[model samples]
Every structure is written in C-alpha cells, then in structure tokens.
Target chain A: MAFVVGMLIKTAAVPIVVAVVVTWLLHRLERLKPHAATLGVACGFIAGWFFQEFSVWFPVRYLDWFPAAALILALLPRVSPITAAWLLVPAFPKMVPPRLWAVGLLTVSTYGLAWFLNKATDKIQQRVIVGVFMATGTACSLVLLQSFSLKFAQIAGLLTASLTAALLSANKPYGNAKGLPFLFIGLMCNLMFIGYANTSSDVPTWCFALPLVAPLVLLWNPGSKKLQAVRYALVVTILMVAVIPALLVHPPWEAEH
Target chain B: MSRNILIICAMALLLTGCNSEEATNPSPDAGDNTTPETSSGSGFAVTSENTKVLFVGTKKSGDSQAGGFKEVSGTIGVDGDKITSVNVVIQVDSLFSDQDKLTGHLKNEDFFSVKEFPELTFASSKVEGSGEVTITGELNMHGQTGEISFPATVSVTDGNVKLDAKFKVDRTKFGMNYTGQPDNPINAEVDIEILVNAE
Candidate 1:
C-alpha cells in the first residue's frame, strides 16, 4: 500500500484527478456538447494552472500548449484555416534561438498535416489518426519521465491523453469531425517534445520525430475492413518500438544515481 | 461562442502575467550597501574576495556534493564592536557544482529556477551574543521568504572582522522540493557553511 501510494504521487495523481473532474463536468454541460474540443482545452488549461499554482513539477509553458492547441481546434471549424493558424503566433518568441527555424518548419508541417487530416474520408482513417494522437501523447509523457526525470510532465501527458481518449470514445460515430481534435493534440504534443529536446541533453534527435512519423504507417491502409484492428496494433507497435528504447537508454529513476 | 473564446484569451493573458520576472538580467547592484560615510563611522563593507558561502547536499547514495556561489556582496553594521545589522545578496547564477551538468541542472527549474529567481538574500533583524554570534534574519529565495537563524563564531583582529558559521537548511522551505526518486532520494536537509569578512 505504501509503495502504491508512492507510485501514485510520483505519477502526479492530484492533477490527474482535477483534470478528470473538470473534463467530466464539461462533458455534462448540455451547452458544451457541440464544443467538446474547446471544453478539453479549457480543462487542460485549468489542469496546467492547477499544477503551476500548486508548484507541481511540470513546466508551465509546456502545459500551456494544451489550451493553446484546444483553442486552435475549436476555431478551425469556425473560421478560415489561415485565420485559425494565427493562434500559435504568440508562442514563437519563447522558443530557443537555435530552435526558431525548427519551430517555423514544425508549424508549417503540422499545419499542413492538420489541414490534410481534416479531410479524412472514412472511419478507419479517423481511428488511425486518433490512435496516432494517443501514441504520441503517451510516448512524449514517457520520454519526459525517462529522459528529463519530469514526473509531472509524464503525469500531465497521461491525464491529457486519457481525457482525450474518453472524450473521443464517448462521442463515437466520429466520422470526419474526429480528425480535428486528434490533429490538434498530435501537433501540439510534437511541438512540446521538440521544444523540450532543444533544451535537454541526452535526448536523441530521432526521439523528436518518431512520434510524429510513426502514425504515417497507418496511411498504407489494410485491404480489408476486418484487418483494421491488426493495422492499429501494428502502428502502435511501431511507435512503441521507436519510443521504448529511448526510454530504456535513459531511465529517470536511475538518472540521479 | 465568441464570448467564451474572449474569456479564455483574457484568462490566458492573466495567467501569463503571473509568471515571475526573468532572472537573466539581474540588476548589477540591487542590494543595500553602507555609504562611505556610514562605513567610515560605524559599519564595514563585507569584501566579496574573502567571503565564501558553500553548501553540501547529499545524493541518493548518501554521498555529498559541495557547491557554492562565486559572487556574494554584503555589509555589516557595527557599533563599538557590537554587531548591529547584516545584509547579504548571493547571485544564484554564480552557483557552481562539481560537475558542469549538475551545475546547469541546478540553475534550471528543477532546483533553483535561476531564470525566474536570480538572487538569494538575507537581512538580519536581530543580532545577539559577543564572542559567539547568533543572527536572526529573513532568507529569501525562489520567490519565497522565511526567517532563519544560525550560530556563528565571530572574531575581530587587525581592524578586520570575520564570521564563520555552519548550519543545515531545508531546501523545501525555500520552495525547492525537487527530491528525486523514492528508494534513493536527495536529502532535504543541506549543510551550509558561511564565511564573511569585513574590513
């Protein structure tokens, strides 16, 4: 029991609890039914603030991406793509000097990918996109825990991914509308990882790109509908293959020793 | 819909405002210094060249690592051999650990967050004793301030005053609670030694 409690604290149970409560509340609001992505963003922002105000270990700037990404998703459906893309402009100045060019490249690439994913035709494509988002979020969380010894970031990532998954699951028959939230989260998570990589030592360059690229394996499209589950497993397996080794190379528990 | 977005934007701005001021560009000289006339009369400038503030923290394996500030400046007020007041400012950015990686990590958010809080300061509220010294003061660090007391040995020779002290401080008291790992954790209590020279 003592070890379990220790693990819970290490995993940042407090913030996760707050996030779950907030997400549940937002889900219950009848008025918010059409704006679930916006609700997720708001909840993410609150969770981030809760973490910071309480002096939890997650970097506040990185946590801020949750709301920022949600806002982008919320606006994508309401305005022109060009207008919605402007939402990320405020964060550019905070990037490290050497990372500015990379940020620009990432922004353009993510924007293009999000735009393309927004037009995904079938349920299988949408599911793949969602799976990709889930994998990236989990991978980044693990990376934070293993590479930088950032337990708070790891917990925050887990909470955000779980909340996103719950939200997506509850609102099934997703169709084309599902891509927006997944794309937003995927892009933001990737950006956060990149920003972290720029400042951190011992993080390999491949760790930065693997999550974003791993989802592309799903683009090959299995020939039959019956094989969709196998394809999903394959994509996740590839992502794990890419991410787990990186974590093994630099375990957070062994870092200080 | 627009109203909700506007509210969120406003909240974001408010949250941004709560961030601490950047620690990179600390004021070159921001602490109280006794004026030349004051020093000539009843006080002495604490010379940075001869003063040292060192700290030893225990790692998970119970081994100790010592680090210290390369720069510190302060003043000591005295009236006829009776110490009156003390003021000290330590540059957090000047902290150096045994290893370069540890030094960088200490400066980052995990330990000092020097980018957000660049200076640690102490100002004495009361000073007592003669041969031995007891200083009750406020120590400010990591955007938090708290009172602390430590005993010291004081000596005056050749028109110069010197103080030596050793004490333990809880890092969590100053909001630095980055204790790592459950099985092998960084010790919360850090041993600190202070040496001050004033002439």
Candidate 2:
C-alpha cells in the first residue's frame, strides 16, 4: 500500500484527478451555456495556477505565470485583456532585457495564432488544430521530463493529455461545438517553457519540429464511410509519430559508453 | 485556410527559436580560481592509484549505500609536519555505485550533470590544527561553490603522507536536490570518507 501510494504520487495522481473533475465539469457546463468552453478553459487555467502554487510538480515561477496570463487573454479577450497583459509583468523582472522582449513578443504572437485558429469555419478543423497543439505540447513536455529526470513533466503531460481528450470528445458532432483553444495555448506555452528550461544535452532538432509537423497528416481528408473513425485514427497516428522519435532520440537513461 | 497553414508554419519556425541547449548546459568553468597549479618537486602529488574517495548516502528507510570514485588527483603543499594547502579534483564520470543504474543516474542531470559539471574540486583556503587537522576549503560541484570544513588525521613517514577523514556534506548545497519519493526519500546529508596518500 505504501509503495502503491508512492507510485501514485510519483505518477502525478493529483493532476489526473484535477483533469477528470475539470472534464466532467466542462461536459456538464456545456449543456447549460453557449460559451461553456471558455469557462472550462478558464477553470483549467486557474486549476493549473493553483496546482503550481500548492503542489511540488509545478514550479511556482514566472515561466508558469505567462501561460495562465496568455490563456486569460485568449479566452476573455474583451473582459480581461488589460489585466492579462498586466500578468506578464512578473516575467520581466526574471529575464534580461533582450530575452524579456523576445519571449514577450513570442507569447503575444502565439496567443494571436491560437485566437486565429479558434475562428475556423469547419468544426473538425478547429478540433484538429487544438488536438495538434495539445498533442505536441504533451509530447514535448514528456521528452523534456524524460531527458531532465523531472517529476513535474509527468504532471504537465497528464494534464494536457486529459484536456485534449476532453476537448476532442466534447467537440463531436452531437456534442458541444464550442472547443477550448485558449486552454491548449496555455498548456503548450507551459510545456514549451519546460522543454526550454530542462534541456541539458543535444536533443535532435527534429524532436522540436515533429509536433508542429504531425498535424499536416490531418490535411489528407479521406471521404470514407467511416470518416469520423478515420479522422480519429489520423490524429492518434500523428501524435504517436510525433512522440516516438522524441522518446528514442538521446533518451535520458542511456548511459555514455 | 491557406493563411492559417502559413501562420502555423511560421509559428513552428518561431518555436524552433526556443531551442536552448546553452541555457541548460552552462559553460564549464574552473570556478573562483580555486584550482591551483601544481609545481613539480614542491608539493606532494596525489594520484588515482593512491587515493580513495567514498560517499555514503542514506535512503528514506535509513539504509545507507556506499559509492566511490575510481579516479582522483590532487596536490598537497606541506612544510614539515604542517600542511600548507591542498587542491583535489574528483572525476564525476568515474563514480562507481554498487548498482550500475544508480551510477548512471548520478551522472545524469538529476545529480552531477556530468556533461556540464565533469569534475568536483576542493581547494583549501586554510589548514589548521596540530594532530587532528581541520581543512577549510571551497568545494565546487554542479556549477555551484560552497565553503566546507572537515577534520582529518594526518600521518607522515619516510616522505609519504596518508590522510583519512570522514565528513558529512549536504548534497542540496551543491544543487543536487533530488530527494527521491515521500516514502523512499534520500537523506540530504551524504557521509563522505576520504583517504589520500601523497608521495
């Protein structure tokens, strides 16, 4: 029992529980409201920040703050743009002048890209875009965690994967059409920060590109009888392809001969 | 749609900018100018063949595991029975644990980050005491330096010196802060036993 409990904590059981509860809440909330996806994303962002503050898995630092701030801006652009912009103030003190400017620009641009992707005419396209973002973020975070031997990477990956699964399920034809791109943007930013911060060795350049490239597979729209199944299969295949190389290349455990 | 694809491609290209091997792997430095050059025919020379540096770390269960380095080289300046100075460098890559997996893990980024911090060095700032000697020095490891003091018994005979010391060092002080799991936590204080033979 002691060993089991230890393993559970090590595998990030807290984040898993949080993800399950958030997914259930999103499913229920979507039934009652039109902008339920936005609310759900906001909830997730808050949960991530809360966990970072209280849990050992997430570092309570500027890197974690930027993602939550970006999410707020994306989700509630009209209501919280100024407040969210203010949230980025914490990042300035931690970085040098040049780095602060570069990261600041990147954060704003990425948030813009997520906002643009959210405006897709086709529902499937929007879901696919969000899926790709989450999948890539998960893969990158996993690789970073594995490479650096960080326990928190597991929590980050679990949270992102859970959110992706929830988003994909919630956006089915009969389900709520509203998807959570803002949440994914925040998660991706967090994972990207982890990847950048944890990398101590020469990881293959292709590992970084795989997540971005995997979604291209979705462009092949097969008009089959089982169209939904094919799309799901394609998404899964893309994610697997993106993640496998990262696990294989310069694996953290491989000892130097 | 075409614009979206282009934007995503641009985003991917921008993310490529986030690739940072330099940030994680700090530039190696022989920190604080503590590594002193050994002059021939002056200071007593210490080599791998004549030195043994063993470290004992405890698990959360209070069980201790011992590990040692196969290679260490140093120089100790002596004036008669009084030790003047000492400079020792232990190869991080040369660590030998009872468990091979543990050895590999120790060399990884979680502990020594051997690729970045390949060597651990101790350069004595002051050496005092008559019979049982106390050496105060700056220990550099894992890109961090801290002052440390240890007591050792020194025995010199026929131009050969053998020094033995057992000391406790907090691994967290050197940035080695992985403390295992809650039920299986590793003790922060590592017991180190040093045996140096200089000729």
Candidate 3:
C-alpha cells in the first residue's frame, strides 16, 4: 500500500513539475497566451506518447518525413525551413533502433524530396511539415545503411544481414550492451509465467524514483534553442537504448513471491 | 529572496543527513556493534586461500525481474572483529535473461550505458560486528558516489570464512530512466544479496 502511494507520488510529481517548467519556457519565449500554452502542452504530451509507443513502427516514427515529402508544397519559403529544422531532433541519436531508423529514413527521404519540390510551389501545410521530415530522415537512413544504393532489394538484404549479424554477436556472453534487454524480457516472461502459476513478491518502495528525476531536469531547463530541442531527443535516445537491457538482465526469482 | 535560498540550503542539509550512512543497522532491535579495540582469544585468521564474493539484485517490477548479480569480484581483509578494508566490483551487464536481443539493448544507452559507466563498485570504510556485521562503504555507480551500509553476517568455522549481506540499490543514482514500457521498467530498489568467502 505504501509502495503504491509512493509510486503514484513519484509519477505525478515529475510530470507536474515538468509541465510547470515547460509552460514557463513557452510563455517566456513564444509569448503564447495561457490557453495557447495549455493547448501546446497537451499537444506536446500527446506527441511524447506518440514518440513512446508509435515510433516503434517505421511509418509512425518517420512521420516527420512527411514535410520533406511535401517538398512540392514546401517550396514556399516560409514552410521549408521549419520542416528542415524538425529533422535535427530525430537525427540526434546516431544509432536509433532498427525498425525506426529504416522506416524513418525511407519515409523522410521520399517526403523530403517532395518538400523540396513543393518548395518551388509554396503550398505546404503546417501539419504536413513534421511528417515530411520524418519520412525523409527514415528514407535517407535506409540509403546510408545500404551505402546509398537505390536498389530496394539490396537495401532490404543489407538490413537483414545487419540484423542477423547483431543477433549472432548478441548470443555470445559479451560484446555490446545492446543485447541485454532482449535477454531481460525473456527472463521476465518466464518469471511472469511462474508468477502466474505461483505467487509474485511485492516490489520495494524505491522503484519509483527512476523516471522522476530525468524528466524534471529536462522540463525545467529545456535550455538553449539547440539544447532544448536536443535535450528531449537526448532523453528519448538514452531511454530507448537502456530500457531493454535493464529488463533482460533482471532476475526471474525476484518476481517470485 | 535570500530567505528562500536559506530555506533551500537548510532543506538540502536535512536531506543529506537523512540519506547519510548509519553506523549500524537502522533497527534498534539489532545488536549494538562497535569496532573492537583490544585483541581477544586467537583471532580467526582468514585462510589466505579460496575466498570469493557473490552479489545479487533484481528489477522486481516494471519490465525487469530479480536475479543474482554474476560478475562480482572483490577483496575482503579481516583483522580480529574489525573488517579493515573491503572492495567489490559488479559488472552491471551480467544479469541473465532468456532472450538475446533484449540483453544487448540492456547494455545500450537507455539502460546501463555500460560503455560510459561499466562497473558498480563499493569500498568499505568501517566494519564492526555486534550480532550482525555492519559494514559502511562508499558506493560508486553510474558516475555518482554515496555512502551506504550493508547488514551482514560473518562466521569462521573449520578452515573457511563466510560473509553474507542483504541490501537495496537505486538505479536512479546512475541516471537510467526510460518510459516506453513503464509497467516493467527498471526497479529503483535493486535488492542486493552478497556472499563472500575470505582466504
């Protein structure tokens, strides 16, 4: 009962603090009205959720690619730069996950070229800008993985080969930390299965603190324009990389009651 | 105003003291143990051979579970009732799981960031035996250092020495927080179990 209260406190405390800080920043810089700021916060929250859940799929992750695809519409001088700017966020993590990177690069490049085209026409929509950038970045990443080959089969083959190599190397005891999360999940599934058959123990009180600190830091000081944008990207990147291993390496017995 | 600053400072100091390492077990029911001064009967000499240490921790809730930490390597020096010095190294990536893909990701940036900060280590400053062994040490993990204590039991029988301790570790100290699957995320309180044999 105490643990549950603590966890709720921890979870609520951080996000509330973050919302305050972010709200302050938007008001200070963008001079957005209170209502507009509220709307933006809601949008940001939704966007965060999208980044968390949907980005796993290539198409959703690469939504930023749509702006680039709108290059035809983005030919308008005002819109192209804004769409281009969003690219900086996703590109921060050099090694994004396999699915996200592949889809993102493909979609971003395709849309980016389109945006470049629209840049000549000047009919880009604000909504489409984020999407085009996502697509273009995803598309370009695919190209880079395939060493810029235009051939689709070659690109798919390269992706498969890369995945196979990563998996093969992961089977060994050591090499890179990237392989730990998968192992952790397997252990947890076994535990959960056992937990279903038997009993599971209560998690300790302090488990609630992990998510609280980092988000508070990011929200409070989104920092300079470059850093503010990069900060979110950085937080997301680190979490993306670390969560799986933390789970894989987790012991099965602890879950036992 | 300056008053707010002063209040903040005072609050910080209070927190520091609250989190500071205690000399012995936090429970009053536990025996009161202090560093012994004079030598008693024949001091139990740790067999200068065949001593090893084991550490275990678990994620508990969220995306992870519980298990023994496999890559623990450390040294124990005992002199009479006092443990003069103890140093230990835990490979954060050693937690085992069935799937290979997840383990690889555990070592990635979202988790241990093993490349950036690989080892979780502790060096004891003082050890005293009352009923249970109380060892206070400086623990270093994820680039942060803090003083912590582990309640332990020590015994010497035949030619072997055994040391056991159980405690908790917080992963937030190392800056690992990812929310994709919060239900099974890394548990902040990593239960640590240690067993050591001294030579």
Best by TM-score: 2
B-chain TM-scores per prediction: 0.80, 0.82, 0.61
Q: Write the per-residue lDDT of candidate 1 for residues B1-199, one digit (tens) a residue.
A: 4673555455445534565323222332344443223333366676569799999999778887889998888777776666767788887878987765566567655677554466788888888997698999988887678899999888765568888999988998887777765676789899999888777
- Write one digit per residue (lDDT tens) for candidate 2, span A7-73: 4343444444555465556567635344444444445545554553223334343333544563565
Worst 10 residues of 2 chain B by lDDT: B20-29
- Candidate 2 Cα misplacement greater than 4 A, ranges: A1-122, A125-148, A158-212, A221-228, A238-257, B1-34, B37-41, B45-50, B69-74, B90-100, B115-119, B157-159
Instruction: Kindly give the stretch of ten consecutive residues in candidate 1 chain B with the minimal lDDT sum.
Output: B20-29
Question: How many residue pairs clash per model?
Answer: 0, 0, 88
Check candidate 2 and list the clashing pairs: none
Residue B2's lDDT within candidate 3 is: 59
After TM-score superposition, the amount by which residue A127's alpha carbon in candidate 3 deviates from its true location, in angstroms, is: 6.3
Question: What is candidate 1's TM-score for chain B alone?
Answer: 0.80
- Per lDDT, the best of the predicted structures is 2
Docking class of 3: incorrect
- Per-residue accuracy of model 3 over B1-199 as CA lDDT, tens digit each: 3563355345444543564222111111111222233233333222213333333334435344444445655555555554555666666556443443344335444455443345667767887774377899888775567788878887655444577777776666644444333454445566666766654
TM-score of each: 0.62, 0.62, 0.38
Candidate 2 has a DockQ of: 0.10
